[model samples]
Target: MYQASKQRYETMPYRHVGQSGLRLPAISLGLWHNFGDVDRLSNQKEILCGAFDRGVTHFDLANNYGPPAGSAERNFGRILREELGQYRDELVISSKAGYYMWPGPYGEWGSKKNIIASCDQSLQRMGLDYVDIFYHHRPDPDTPIEETAGALDLLVRQGKALYIGVSNYSAEQTVAIAKVFKKLGTPFIIHQPRYNMFDRWIEDGLTDVLTQENLGAITFSPLAQGLLTNRYLNGIPADSRAGRSSSPFLSPENVEATINKVQQLNQIAQNRGQSLAEMALAWNLRQPTVTSVLVGASRLSQLEDSLKALNHLDFAAEELAQIDAIVGK
Candidate 1:
């Protein structure tokens, strides 16, 4: 009963994942927060459909995305079965593992057992045979880099995943794993890091490593988990992410620390004829290695607003310098 847009690809841009042949939409949808069972199924469907209608073909997920665990994938799987299954090849779906899932020792981390099992569980939940990209959510301090890399390599060999990626890894850790992946001939092509105007840690050394290894980066929390948006320009609304007691990453003190800079950034965005959110997302895409900007949109309007970032991805030298000065470069 659902129809896709005839002009879906009219405006959206797709960027290559490093040197790989694959390309992802510049603005990919992330089901990190609101696609779970706690949210309305109707809202979720609307957002997903709206994204695809705008040419967003990639959807990022993880095993532990739901508060109840695995609910986001289930809900998305239902949406796919009923609405988008016919377009499976046109979509690039990714899921990650590394957080706690079950209770036993094999329940989490980057071990061969946990990684493979988590991928299987994700595939089952989504009613799919293989995901486009599978990621190890984070580095395990205890696991050897070779072992973790081996587990991911095995996923591709077993036909459970097409490409391998890692999230929240350091430059050194990435290089270590890349070595093993290269030897095993794994198609490890992407890295997901928490990057934003406020959080520029990826710029330190990770960007260089990614460039050298030819591994693309898709950034998470590009808006500093909602701080770079207009939601907190005046004050944190009761419904805003920072106002929620559950996600303490953006506490009142954190918002206070960056409010001045955020306001300045908003002014620059207004000058560029974009909202703060659009400018913030464009800032992340400005990085050469960032193949896509992965963000969560609970509503269709938010997704529409985000898609506007593509309109003005270019920045003047003075604008860049002003942003750097405001964020204390």
Candidate 2:
């Protein structure tokens, strides 16, 4: 008996994916961290519903998102079935396959067998007939690009996915596979890259390729895995991701290396009347080729804070230059 806000679409902005007919909200919800078996279902429902109420129509997931693997999809599927089933057509649910999922050789990589089988398994876990956009999680050095692109095209033909994308691909890799997808007549629409003020690798060449190829780009980790947020300004909290011993990505040394830069950036964000997180998210969207930014929040308040970045998406040239100087861009 949950009701979505009638004013959901009033505040959120939607942009077309490249030159395609599909569009996505400026901020898409990413279920990478909190929507897992270890988390409570009620909390998950609350966050999901809160995001939808604010016009987050796209929910990004992957086959290996959960620590236990596939748990996030199972949890999200239950939430969809028990709470938001009525809003299925109104939402764009995306899932990717490219990381480790199972025990044997067929479990990982971008081979034809792995890609197709992973999509099927993801669909089953999510209790869905078709996902809006399915992505190849990463490039497989051992597999032929042709096989991977062919598998995605096959998924579209089988009616399992509407559009296709690739994540963590370089400019060269994207151009190579894009040609194959173009020849196959696959509706390859988007590329998911890790981009933020701290990570500028995509700007080196990927953005140009995406723009040239007319492919939309959605950036993951737009907050630089929480480094761009205010959480670490005073030092890492005992409960924060950086404080956790098991977190492979954010380490104490890494935080120490970038803490001063983060503090400097915070001052700039304060001058602009925005939080560090808001400015970070806005920075990624400044690129016209970037269709959307994928963000994950453990609570409704965090999500609300992220949505505020839309208020000041416009940045002066001086501000951009200052940011680049502070981050050593």
Best-fitting candidate, scored by lDDT: 2
Q: Report clash pairs, candidate 1.
A: none
How much lDDT does each candidate structure score? Answer: 0.93, 0.94
Query: Tens digit of lDDT per residue, candidate 2, span 1-329?
Result: 89999999999999999999999999999999899888888989999999999999999999998757999999999999998999999999999998999989999989999989999999999999999999999999999899999999999999999999999999999999999999999999999999988888998999899989999999999988889999899898999889998998898777888999999999999999999999999999999999999999888888998999999998999999999999998
lDDT of 1 by residue, 1-329 (tens): 78899998888899999999999999999998899999999999999988899999999999999757999999999999988888899999999999999999999998888998999999999999999999999999998888889989999999999999999999999999999999999999999999988889988999999999999999999888789989889877887767887876878777778888889999999999999999999999998889999988879998998988999999999999999999998
List TM-score per model, in order: 0.98, 0.98
Error of 1 at 16 (Å): 0.6
Show model 2 residue runs off by greater than 4 Å.
none
Model 2 Cα RMSD, Å?
A: 0.9
Residue-level lDDT for 177 in candidate 1: 92
